[model samples]
Target: MDLSTLMLLCVFAFTAGLVDAIAGGGGLIQTPAALVLLPQYPVATIIATIKLPSFTGTGLAIGQYIRRVRLHFPTAVLMCITAFGAAFAGSALLTMVSSRFMKPVIFFILAGVAVYTYTKKNFGEHTTKPYSRKKQLWYAFLISLVIGFYDGFIGPGAGSFLILAFIALLGYDFLHASANAKLVNMATNSGSIALFLLKGTILWSVALPMAVCNGLGGIIGARLAIAKGNHFIRLFFLCIVTATLLRLAYDVFVKN
Candidate 1:
């Protein structure tokens, strides 16, 4: 990549990490920008290259969240394990099958999520009554499996979905949900990265510099989210979800 193009990608990566740290739709920014900027590369290569930066960004955000947020370690670990395995499977499947079929379904689901979150008011602001430990573990497993697969396969809004699941299924507030979602997201990214590395698809020239910018953005964004609290995250979440929904709508209805 030329210096100018590389610089542009870094900018997008930074912005993506910032938004993703707060609300989980970084791929909407980073992936599309990479695809647009590097049309010479295969789509798979671009996507795979993006994962390394994403992993680093999420890792940095997790570091920040760990200091301020209380995570449910047992369920979080279960989710991470399940997410890692599911993401690996999903990435393997992606090499064989087209992911185009998933876009419409996810579009509708995100629409519903956006609507529900907007109307519910106070949703994710405070924790609800806790589920039983068994139920929580089951919910976490199922959520990680489904969303992690989606992350590895479809590759957008997975972080948002993770936060949503943590809030709706596990009765976590926005902050705690985001913290745990970062953990699961990191695992999913690692799984996808492992697959991509095996396939030798990553563009390290771009991924390395972008990773630094993204990680720096993650640090700032995570600290901002920690300072601003749940209300800020809820607003950011809604915005990212809406943006993801619109992007999917275009891909499904317009691009095709």
Candidate 2:
């Protein structure tokens, strides 16, 4: 890549990591930017290269979140295990199938999520009524499997979806949900990265520099979220979801 192009990608990577650390739609920024800038590369290679930066960013965010939030270890562990496997399956499927069909479906879902979150003023502000441990585990498994698959397959907004699931299904507050989401997100990213490595699709020269910039952004963003708390996160979530909705709309209606 030329110096100017590399610099532009680094800027986008940092922005993506910052946004993603706070709300989980970093791919909205990073993936599209890479695809647009690095048109010479195969689409799969661009996607795979981006995953390394994503994984590193999520890792940094997790480190910050862990120190501030109380995570449910049992639930998180179950979710991570399921998510990893599901992500691997999903990534494998991506090589065989067109993901165009999923865009409209996800767009609608995100719309509903944005509306519900907006109208329900207290949503995710505090923990909801608790589910039994067994129920929580079951819910976590399902949420992780589905969102992890989506993460690997569709490749955007999976973190936000994970957070939404944890808050809505598992009765977690925003901070707790974000913390758990980071763990599951990390697992999903790792699963996809592993597959890409085996397939020899990633361009490490691009991914490595992006990863450093992304990680720095992740650290700052996570700390900001922790300091700002639920209201800030809720607003950030809405903005990210809105952006994802628009991007998907463009893809489904205009691009296609």
Candidate 3:
């Protein structure tokens, strides 16, 4: 890429990192920035480049969260393994599934999720009873498996979906849900990174700088979210869901 374009990409990565750190939808920003800047490259290459920044950002955010809030280790571990395995399997079968056919349905689901959260009073504001360990494990495993597969096969809103699943199905409050979502998202990104590596789709030059920018953004965002607590997360989650829904609508209906 040209110097000007490269700089633009870095800026986008920085912004993407900040958004992702707060609300879990950085791809909604960084991926499009890659497409706009590196129009000549394969989509996969653009995506891989974003990964470098995303992983770095996630690592930073994880550290930030670890310092302030204790992560649920068992949930994190199970989700990661399931997500990793599922993403691998999904990547292997990527060619078989067509995202266009699925996009409308995904959009509708996201719409419902967004609406439900908006309308429900106290919807993700308070921690409810912890599900039985076995139940939580099962839900987390299934969610990771299905959502992880989606991340590898056709990626969009993977983080948002993971957060939504944890909140609605597993009954986590927004703060814990966001925290748990990162662990799962990190796995999803790792899975996508490995597959993109196998396919040789990553543009390392772009990815490296963007990764640093995105990492910085993640660190700042995660720290702020941790400091603010659940009320802030719930509000931010609604904002992200709205943005995600709009993105899906444009992609599925307007652009397509």
Candidate 4:
């Protein structure tokens, strides 16, 4: 990499580490940085590089969240299987279709999700669960399949959105939902990484330092958020998701 690109990558990697550690949308930081810094880079490589740091960031985030938030193993397992399979299929199919075609619709979807969460007064503040295992499982299945496929295909903010869906649909508090999102999101990233490895597009040099920094960031961020408690995390989540929505919306309608 050139000096400019190297500097850019370093900055992006650090930002990604911090953002991902806090609320799990680090890809939104690093992927676009790759696009802008390495304009000549293949789209495939851009995608693969994203997974390298993310895997590290999320691996740490997962451990941190699990330490703090109690998990429902059965639902997490179901989510993992479905998400991994769906993401693999989605990534394979992604090359065949143009993601740009869906940008407008996706913009609307992001706006709606952001608005929905903002409108809810106590959405992520506290746990208020009331359900049977069977009911939660159905939502978990849908979340894994839908979000996982989207993650593999488009590859941004997948973790945050998964958590939101888990909270809204399953009535999980933000903390538990975040823990669950980590499990399912791991599968999505793993699946996409597997496909990218097959494509031979990853650059280990760019990915290695990024992964280490991201891992440290994840550990620090997760611990801080847990210590700070629900209200701070919820607001922080809102800020990142809203920022992502704006960026994606602009990328879709204006930039295109």
lDDT of 4 by residue, 60-152 (tens): 888998887888888889999999999988898886786777667777777887787788879886566687879889989999999999998
- The global Cα lDDT (0 to 1) of model 4 is 0.81
Q: Name the candidate, 3 or 4, with the larger lDDT value.
A: 3
Sorted by lDDT (best first), the order is 1, 2, 3, 4
Candidate 2 lDDT over residue span 22-87, tens digit each:
988999999999999999999999999999999999999999999888777877788888999999
Candidate 2 Cα misplacement greater than 4 A, ranges: none
Cα lDDT tens digits for candidate 1, 1-256 = 6899999999999998888898899999999999999999999999899999999999999999999998878888888899999999899999999999999999999999999999999899666656787877888899999999989888778999999988888788899888888999999999999999999999999999999999998999999999999999999999999999999999999999
Candidate 2, TM-score vs. the true structure? 0.98
Model 4, stretches more than 4 Å misplaced? 127-129
Candidate 1: where is the Cα deviation over 4 Å?
Answer: none
**How many collisions per candidate?**
0, 0, 2, 0
Could you tell me the TM-score of candidate 1? 0.98
Model 4 residue 207 lDDT score: 81
Q: Write candidate 3's Cα lDDT for 7-42 as tens digits.
A: 898888888887787778888888887888788987
* Between candidates 1 and 4, the TM-score winner: 1
Which prediction has more favorable TM-score, 3 or 4?
3
